[model samples]
Target: MNCPKCKSVQIIKYGHTHYGKPRFRCQDCGRQFVLNATRQPIDEPTRQLIDKLLLERLALAAIARVTGVSERWLQMYVFQKFYQTPKAIDVTPKKQVG
Candidate 1:
């Protein structure tokens, strides 16, 4: 098979990945990769559930265990949300009653 990066036919069997997939190294570019690797994306309903859990102030690891998502991904998601939120807010306080 040709190398994905340099499109060169010169490649060698490097080793098996942690997932037991055969990985190849391109001789031209020295890039190693596995073919046909796939990642399943989390669904929208699960995301909504995660949002609700976040509102409840649940622990991140607990959320990851309950939601079947990786803690790293959840942390990145939270970081992205934090940056997307508005910086300023308007608040009005009531005067003290007699």
Candidate 2:
């Protein structure tokens, strides 16, 4: 078997997953992964829809429900796509002397 992440052919049988699925490990990248997994990657149209929903300023939960994606994943995606460091704010209170 080959490693999905590194496309390396130096793979060996690892341990079983929690679901009892056979797992394999790649010697080259040291990544252990399962083969013939049922989970599929998100498609382009769905990603576009997520982007559109985000542009509309919808809540993360709402976007996840509409896009069939997890809220945590959406949050990470939004952060990666548009996250910027905010400018520092000065909040020192001035003392009033009578």
Candidate 3:
């Protein structure tokens, strides 16, 4: 079989994926792929909804259920977002009211 990325005929058997699907690796570009992929990527609208739900402080399980996404994926996404945020924040002092 040919590599999808580089369209090279140099391909090798890579191991099975977590879901037990047979995986192959391209020797040309080092890309791993399955013959038939079953998992569909989450779309942009669903991602926007997830962001809104995260802002609402909803439980991870609840967000996953509502958005129909795997909790594992949501957790990883949140982990990435957490690290992407600035480490330090500047706060303004509040003025005293009479």
Q: Estimate each model's TM-score.
A: 0.46, 0.45, 0.47
lDDT of each: 0.78, 0.75, 0.80
lDDT for model 1? 0.78
lDDT of model number 2: 0.75
lDDT by residue (15-97, candidate 2, tens digit) is: 99978999999999999988753244566798899988867878789999998887767765676565444243343323323
Preferred candidate (TM-score higher): 2 or 3: 3
Q: List candidate 1 stretches off by more than 4 Å.
A: 1-38, 85-98
Give residue 79's lDDT in candidate 1 (0 to 100): 66
How high is the lDDT of residue 65 in model 1? 96
Best by TM-score: 3
Model 2 CA RMSD to the hidden true structure, in angstroms: 11.9
lDDT of 1 at 82: 60
Give the clashing residue pairs of candidate 3, or none: none
Candidate 3 per-residue lDDT, tens place, 1-98, comes to 68867889999999999889899999989999888632546667988999999888788899999999999888767766765553654432233233
> Which pairs of residues collide in model 1?
none
lDDT of 1 by residue, 1-98 (tens): 78867789999999999789999999999999787532445567878999999888888899999999888788767766665553543322223234
Instruction: After the best TM-score superposition of candidate 1, give how far the Cα of residue 91 lies from its true spot, in angstroms.
Output: 24
